[model samples]
Target: MGKVTAGLTMSLDGFIAGPNDGPDHPLGEGGMRLFDWYTSGDTDYVVPSGGMTFKISSRAAEMLQEVFSSIGAIVTGRRTFDITNGWGGTHPIGEHVPIFVVTHSVPEGWDYEGTPFTFVTDGVESAVEQARAAAGDKNVAVSAASVIQQCLRAGLLDEVHVDLVPVLLGDGVRMFDHLGREHIELERTRIIEDPDVTHLTFRVVR
Candidate 1:
């Protein structure tokens, strides 16, 4: 069995993305600042998917390597899928790692052959189930704000990892919103400090 986890780079103000996020403005206005840490160092780290490379601190590179290697599959929202244009047919984590997109309907002209994406119109739970089945012993990473919120509300997530950036976006897409009025307890598991960002991990106290 694999643990279900949600990870994202968020601002100090608890925003995962700046306001008005869309295809044209993927990270929202000034949201790209959230990822400045990716290039704020001297160490070169190539992504597992071979899609891109990042210049980050040695510690950040180590953390990224550990995290990326542990993920076997991903479950994300349709909005995210569309924003990245399906990661140009191959996700950043690599084609070997399957991607389950929670969408209302399959997009037009999306060929299934040789593609790692799976459009799950049924719902987030079904998507998570399918992703877990594909992931096997590795972890299933749940991305996107809405999808993560759904998983948290449904009690499907086991852990949450946030790369806290030093910024305050006055208005943006909040990561911890719409999770209902109920308090969800979390046990802090790990914290890695860096000049660019702080990596925080917590186990969902179910």
Candidate 2:
């Protein structure tokens, strides 16, 4: 069994993506500023999927490496899957890790040989379950605001990691919206500070 975690870079005002986000504007207007920390340092870190690389601080690079290495599978929303164009057939985490997309219906031409994607139309719960099963001892990463919200509401998430950027986006897609009125207590577990971003981790208090 493995813990279900949700992680993403977010603005100080609690936005994950700026307003008017779409395929053409994946991160929304001016949202690219949120990722400035990725290339603001000297240490070179390559994505396991071999899709990209980043120059970050030694501490940030080491933390990212540890986190990336622990991920065995991913569960994300269809909107995110489409936003990144399915990460060009292979997720940035790695090709070996399976990705379960929570969607109402499978997209046409999405199925192909040696694909790492699996469409789950039933619900987020089913998708998370499948991801956990596939992950074995490793962690199941939940991505996208909608999917993470669903997991949080359903009590399926064990941890929340946020790369807190400095700037504040006045209007945009929020990461912690629609969670109902229930108070979800979180135990702060760790904080890794960098000049451009602050990595915060919390354990969901069940």
Candidate 3:
């Protein structure tokens, strides 16, 4: 089975998103700034106006690329799927990277024109199992903060990588809030420092 891993860029204050995150503001107000490290690279993404490109530092881009290459499938939340407009019908992760969305109810005609999403309503464990099966030997990556927390609490996640951006969002959705009393063991596996952000990886000690 493929390893279940998750990664995200977060502010020092621990928010993965800023306030008022919605369809109009996907990452929330100024939340897009958190991903400056990745977008700084000449990475192309779909925007409302059309395709846009941004450049990040070469070293930061290279490190981000390494993480992107290992993901075979992605698991995210319904809110995330909605906020991104299903990644504008072309997932930011990749066109071929299948997404398994955990939701309470699968929407009618859930599949988009070019992008099809697998909606798992059973629970996070079912979503992870299906994502793992779809991923084959590569890693199944959890992208949304809520889903990442679910994986952590369920003890299904194998690794976590965070690009710790040097900023603070005083209010917003926190990444590690209200996780209950369960303790998850972690071992630092890698660290890469850059002027914009620091990339850190930790193995989930089993």
Candidate 4:
């Protein structure tokens, strides 16, 4: 079995999408700022490794790639999958890792860029089961809206890598929209600041 993780770039105000998110503007106005950490390749966001070039060139991307490399499967909500556009519809996983998208309506066999997309709606847990089974010994990563929340609620999230941007969005699609009354402890926090953004990692303690 592999660890399940929820990783996302968030704003200081605890938002992932800006206030005006929609079909016309999925990211919303000022939304892109939440991920400035990646665009600038700020060293502050880069984790200390053997000091490889890929680590410094694109820390977020490199981190994501490393994370994905260990992934045997992925689960994401419909809306979250849509955010990636039709690109994911045809090729859900960029690295050929299997992806199971939890959605209400399943198309008559969805295929993306030679990659097969399996849509499930039995429930979040069901999706997780299928993903984990398919993943076997590899990690199963869950991304997108409600899905991450559901996992967190189920006490399924083992760890998370957070790249905190240095901005505040007064209103937007927040990351923890429904954390409820439970409080989680932070195991660690690291800062990496560049001209574009600041990276912060917080390990979760249940």
How does residue 206 of candidate 3 score in lDDT? 82
Q: lDDT of candidate 2 vs native?
A: 0.94
User: Tens digits of per-residue lDDT for model 2 on 1-206?
Assistant: 88899999999999999999888889999998998999999999999978899999999989999999999999999989999999889888988999999999999887898889999999999999999999999999998899999999999999999999999899999999999999999999999999889999999999
lDDT of 1 by residue, 1-206 (tens): 98999999999999998999988888999999999999998999999978799999898899889999999899999999999899888888998999999999999867778888889999999999999999999999999899999999999999999999999988889999998899999999999899879999999999
Candidate 2 or 4, higher lDDT? 2
By summed lDDT, which 10 consecutive residues of candidate 2 come out lowest? 106-115
In angstroms, the error of model 1 at 84 is 0.6
Write down the RMSD of candidate 2 (Cα, Å).
0.7
Q: Clashes per prediction? A: 0, 0, 4, 5
Colliding residue pairs in candidate 4: 44-192, 44-193, 90-112, 90-113, 91-112
Root-mean-square deviation per candidate: 0.9, 0.7, 3.1, 5.0
Segments of candidate 4 deviating more than 4 angstroms: 42-62, 88-95, 108-114, 189-195
The lDDT values for all models are 0.93, 0.94, 0.82, 0.68
lDDT of 3 by residue, 40-117 (tens): 545443332234444666665566567667788889999998898777766766677889999998877666565658
| Sliding window of 10 residues with minimal summed lDDT for model 3 | 43-52
Task: Give lDDT tens digits, candidate 4, residues 1-206.
Answer: 88787777778788878877766667678787775444444344322222222323355555556775687888888876676564434442454566778888875545545654678879788888988898899888787657888878887777766667768888888888787897766676555555555556566687
Residue 87 lDDT, candidate 2, scale 0-100: 89
Q: How many steric clashes does model 3 contain?
A: 4
In angstroms, give how far residue 70 of model 1 lies from its true place: 0.8
Q: Sorted on TM-score, highest at the top, how do the candidates line up?
A: 2, 1, 3, 4
lDDT of 4 at 70: 80
